[model samples]
Target: MLRGPRRPLWLCLCLCLLLLLLLPGAPGHRGDAGPRNKKAGSGRPWPAFQGLQERLRAAGALSRRYWALFSCRVWPENCEEDEEALAGTLGLKSDLSVRLHGQHLAGELILRTVRGYLELPRPDKALVLSFHGWSGTGKNFVARMLAENLYRDGLRSDCVKVFIATFHFPHPKFVDLYKERLTGQIRETQERCRQTLFIFDEAEKLHPELLEALRPHLGRQAPENYKAQSLRTIFLFLSNLGSNIINEEVLNLLKAGWLREEITLEHLEPRLQAQIVESTDSAFGHSCLVKENLIDFFVPFLPLEYRHVRLCARDAFLSQELLYTEEALDEIAKMMVYVPKEEQLFSSQGCKSISQRINYFLP
Candidate 1:
């Protein structure tokens, strides 16, 4: 105590000890050590499926479509392989199903035959190409919604002449490569179908070159007196790309007439237009399309509210028919609590968050 220099050293040591004690796992520490150290299998539960029974009753929905996507199916061995062959095709490792955030994130590519030669009285001629974004699957919520809508429009599994080809772009590296592969596939498949609609889920991932290649085909009408072949080809590029790439190589392609001017601008929805204009990033901040050329259809990003969450959760739960048990739901729910609400849902962070918890739960 008498030596000034020695006193400061002793004070510094005490302060460090105080910080150590304050940290988790310190003696008498009380805060949650996070989902990792929670009591085995004791966590927030998934809202019970039975709780939604009344809601379903009021909605007058009782079909498998209401809850089948979430449920895992052990299809006959090679069912996926057969389905791929029947549809345009993609290589997948497992039966397609939506995964809980707590489970390992697995990527899958699927092709569901919307309509074809068998159902149609005459050969149909149309194909729809769909692309999904980061952390988004080819068969996730948005894709399923679009599919259901298409199915309701007299487009049966093998009629309407529209072959739906979906690809999974889980990594940036996969984007250009996927486009190259898809271009070849589309060229081959187009000959079989009369017309084609290329749908890009998150078009931003698509390379400029690919979009350029498809531009010549988008919105082109057949020659006059061509028997009205009903060849209404469409290219639907859905992206959060917006105006951000104002000066990127891809944008230059658009400026240089690589893409059809009208198709590029008219296809982008208004919300995306705003995002492009408002964002500060050079790549996405500016408009992707020139004046008068916008997206054909624009589905805005859904609002963020508890009601939206409840709706999404209900939709997700009902889509899968409550396959997860109460315990499993609890484990997943607990894991989600550690993730920020804004950052949750169809995001890679959700995957990492769950993986961390799973590691903690396992021996």
Candidate 2:
């Protein structure tokens, strides 16, 4: 027998218990799922965190990203497909753009602005586009197309923020409150990623003070950092204020027997800006953004003719991945009621109701 100093009998027993607890298949041993299994052991209750982890992984958040790290070996094909979707949408003309029907000017201007933005080392002013036209004339639609092409996740990305005048800031009396909130939102958004795009819809109804608040964000000339930040950010103004004026001009030209091509941006800009001043109660033309020549472009969406409406119906149908024929497209277009019975010239509602109109044709 070895004559070693004997430890306490209780101490020896405690050491054995600890070793057993640490071992696999030991009486008290359990792995990471130990807590999970314990709940299941009694009534087989599921763990919330485990299920959530699965969903996040499926949505390509956690595990998917980790998996993407090794995607070159696992799934290289997906990387090639739509790999440059974001850039492609911006740099090239999309299919929907080709189907823009009567909106060549708007499309060309969008492409020009995008091309110019990409070229600028540091843009002095943000791409401040005021999309002016009647409802469903593709004002919001073009803005959407631009947003989708600019960012991968399209409008869903946090970089894109859309504020509708009626819904987001309905009260004019709270102009100061709205101004502060709007300023804070932009400042916070720009902090995260200066490549932020703010789309203010129904801008015609925005409060004068609120629109004035955007002036600094657009044209800050001092500090290089401020100018750089503003350069990366884009502000899109969507409104229906100048629709009637645009319509009238178009009709007058057509009545005078002038070709559509003759009706140019040169003629429309002054007319639209003048109408914005007369019709819009907000700071549209009155704000420093306008007076200072800060608005980079004023894109007008003109009234859609029958063919244009048909193209819209086609686009809407195709978007839903639905099949259709010329007849169906024509039928939907015909259902649309145009104004001024004499000419029956253009769709009164624009393509705004295409989603609803398509339902009639859909099985």
Candidate 3:
């Protein structure tokens, strides 16, 4: 009886071993047969799959941008801030000398103030510049020039934060929310570097409340804890608040045969201040910056004449490495629509579109 029972048990054990060997996880099926069989149909090699995963992990764990924000490496090649580099940057690199016309005061004042600010061991106040001008008058250009001189990247620098009202804070109803976000961003960026540049473009469209939020950053007397942080930051506001008035004043001087050079900051600034306060947009009219003398410089960019437009055309052609005759350049300039019907010769829109227009004339 024991022999018969033992035979059945041994037979069952043998059958179990056979079943285990036939299953997917059987011993020989592991490394080569089982896993390789599954991936054998895949065209990509195994190393490529590993490489893809490694790249994704590297993008996350060792991201350069994340570290860069917190690191002093935010500024690269700071040698550009030297005096010689600064001179070459503003003098020959961009056509600030040639492009900026009828606004010598604005250029000289900006160069002086910016240079002085950079030279300071620890500036007492942040350099706040409010650029008031019509479109295409080089306010944005000047802002770029400032960044280019300060750093190698120009306006594209990580230290420079350009905020456009239309892009950043569009809705008037949600002005409060925008205010908080804007303030937070400024505060965080300022913490990174003392030489931070904050450019607010289309500032005329910025809600008064939103602009008010920046008052603390632009203040001459920053709070005790924030003094050092505030002085190193520069806030630049580019607006079209008094664009119409500026163009009219220039026309009047020209008609009176007043030398364009005769136009000075004293003649234009007061009028611009008054016009900005009286603007149709209530946001501009009730601006705290206007009420309080917080902004350091109220730089004005005069409208560009036909000659400036021609210069822009020449520059555009040169940039494209195409040499054109004077007649072709004149043809491109004539295509632009100018203002003050009596003086249609002068471009009201400036040289903003000349670069694109020159394309039609080029071979």
Candidate 4:
């Protein structure tokens, strides 16, 4: 009571000021500490409507009904059986056991991922555009496999939707026009969906210029206001083409003084004085590989020779009525052997020994 109270307010203020001056920044403060982590609100920020799935199911049902109606109206004989089969395939019933066997899981994964991204909110800004190769349709069986996976993964066609479009490039005359039209269509799709996951199934079908035009968009980069929207678009060029074709095209461009050499068979195999159509007409030739830049392509899980043997076996089975029993396949596989041409082999020594050779045959 006799002594005056010694307040430490001034000392505390002085200490705070000193600390502020000495410290890099205040705790939890981002001053001069790089970008701030603006945390977005957690939770699925998209519509949780199930109508899309219901609509898809309904559409499937309706299609079945339409088929029944049409069959009954026109040919009435097998309409009931057809309707039942369609219903079973379309999973009309809740407990319908529908099994889809896919040849390639990677392709399925790519397609499913794209579909999932599209199902997210405001998909109009995003898209998954797929490309098909020679004699391939946009609705190829593999593409349908992807679509089926997406559908199974709860991506109802009516929900937060993105367009899955497939484009083809068979002729050169339509290359530029196709690119222009595709670019415009993509932009328009983006404007509507706001997000897109572009998928190119047979990317090799695209003209080099068209591919270059789309290269920037094929990656993970988003345009704007959609940074969080990761566009997992992919370009799967199931071709046998390799970098050699690209090199040849480059050389031709350099020699011709053309600003850009369109990648084609003419540029790649200049020795052959045939049209592009003629060059690609060989049945056994590696057109798929050459056109798709698949040179040096190797399947890590299986040896190249074995893969080729399997492919050959499959092809044989498809073309002819050969029953490929497991034992038979194994036997044929053992007999298959890869014989590298002189020019194709990297080194002469590399092909001297059977063990050293890279085989494309089964044996």
- For each of the candidates, give the backbone clash count: 34, 0, 0, 29
lDDT of 1 by residue, 35-58 (tens): 232333345354353334333222
lDDT of 3 at 349: 76
Please write out the lDDT profile of model 2 over residues 1-363, one tens digit for every residue: 001132454544544444444447766343442112122224324423223222222222222222322343245676642232223333235433444657777877877776567566655667788888888887776677666656656778777889999999988788788888889989887777646789999887777788778878887456656743533677888888778888988888888997765678876888888877675455566767678887888998878888778777766766575665567777888998897689999899887778788998777
**Candidate 2, lDDT over the whole model:** 0.67
- Candidate 3 per-residue lDDT over residues 109-213, each given as its tens digit: 787787676667666667888898878778887887667655546677667889998998888899888988988888777776546888999988888788788
Residue pairs in clash, model 2: none
Candidate 2 runs further than 4 Å off: 1-92, 225-231, 280-283
Candidate 1 residue runs with Cα over 4 Å from true position: 1-140, 148-184, 194-197, 220-222, 225-234, 242-271, 277-294, 314-320, 323-363
lDDT of 2 at 166: 95
Q: Cα lDDT for residue 159, model 1?
A: 15
Q: Global lDDT of each model?
A: 0.34, 0.67, 0.65, 0.34
Instruction: Report how far residue 114 has shifted in candidate 4, in Å.
Output: 9.0
Error of 1 at 257 (Å): 44
Lowest lDDT 10-mer window, candidate 4?
94-103
Candidate 3, which segments miss by more than 4 Å at Cα? 1-95, 99-102, 227-231
> Candidate 1 overall Cα lDDT vs. reference?
0.34
lDDT of 4 by residue, 52-115 (tens): 2323333444344344344444565755432322322322221111111111322333334443
| C-alpha TM-score for every candidate | 0.39, 0.72, 0.72, 0.31
